[model samples]
Target: MNSSRRLVVAVAMSAAFALCLPFTANAGHDDNGTDPDNRSQAVKGFNLTANGTKAMNHGKSQLERSVITTSWGGGDIEVYDKDYGDNGWHGYADCTDWNALWTSCDIIRVRFNQYSYKTSSQWKSLGCHEFGHTADLGHRARSNDTDNNSCMREEIWPLYYDQHDLNAIKAGT
Candidate 1:
């Protein structure tokens, strides 16, 4: 083929490949435990105070009601509550172990900071957000949520997952 024809073909192929790729809002956030196989797994909590236990239980309940099918025991995911003392984050999730292929997580850890006092609703929101991370759900900015109601947002305003978050969890887990 002529040089110009080859260039045109290359451009066309590139565009096609790009179109075939899946789009994820939480693209780069999938590094730790964002494995799909973690769906329907069990989670446990450690070092939890009364409030911390409440938050963990709320998060676990949300996950169980969602399409993820997560249960409240068995150590697949370990949740912890401790005082971080103004670390600028309310909670976080990390994968402690991975599957053989590294595509899925064998064990995950979720932690909640007890430095600041939060309302019951806020605690639930934190729980939902951190747990959402284990199910491959990423943080959703306020701008992305038109209705302004999702636990995945950086702020702890919403106490439950919005439809979009639920949909993402369904697709991911």
Candidate 2:
């Protein structure tokens, strides 16, 4: 395989190992920053409903509402929003985390940054993106300084959603 592809595999492996499949999840609720919610947080996954899956099959769209009851360390997820805590956390207006909750039997949650119903492909891709983090996958290291426009990275994450992204999720992280 080419060096870049090898790097891809290496990155995936590194993230998986970093977790050690431990437990411990964090809470959050910065409103936009880090406002401290003092509630609870968990991520839920449901097999796409018949309609949802049908939409995907027909090139339509679908997205389930995910609530993030933030309360504490903002938990492990990085809460990002110019209006709340840091102006540019997590590279956008979303708090995302690569939490290893298996050992502790906890769960990490991610609050979708925006509300939009794009094509099913897009929504599915977004699921792939967030789920990737749930599985411990992170953006690929940058070619230049630490700023790659790659999908794993934030800059071009909205551009294209490829199979490698799916693979990363499958392989864990």
User: lDDT by residue for model 2 over 1-173, one digit each (tens)?
Assistant: 99999999999999999888754232111022222122233233234444333322221111111122322342433322122233343322233332253222133444333233345444444443443343344555455214332234443344333444444333331
Q: What is the lDDT of residue 115 in candidate 1?
A: 90
Per-model TM-score on C-alpha atoms: 0.81, 0.33
Q: Give the whole-model CA lDDT for all candidates, comma-separated.
A: 0.78, 0.35
Model 2 clash count equals: 16
Task: Give a tens-digit lDDT track for model 1, residues 45-116.
Answer: 786888888888888887876787776665678988888889998898888888888777878788999898
The alpha-carbon deviation from the true structure for residue 48 of candidate 2, after best TM-score superposition, in angstroms, is 19
Give the lDDT of residue 23 in candidate 2. 44
Please report the candidate that would top TM-score against the real structure.
1
TM-score of 1: 0.81
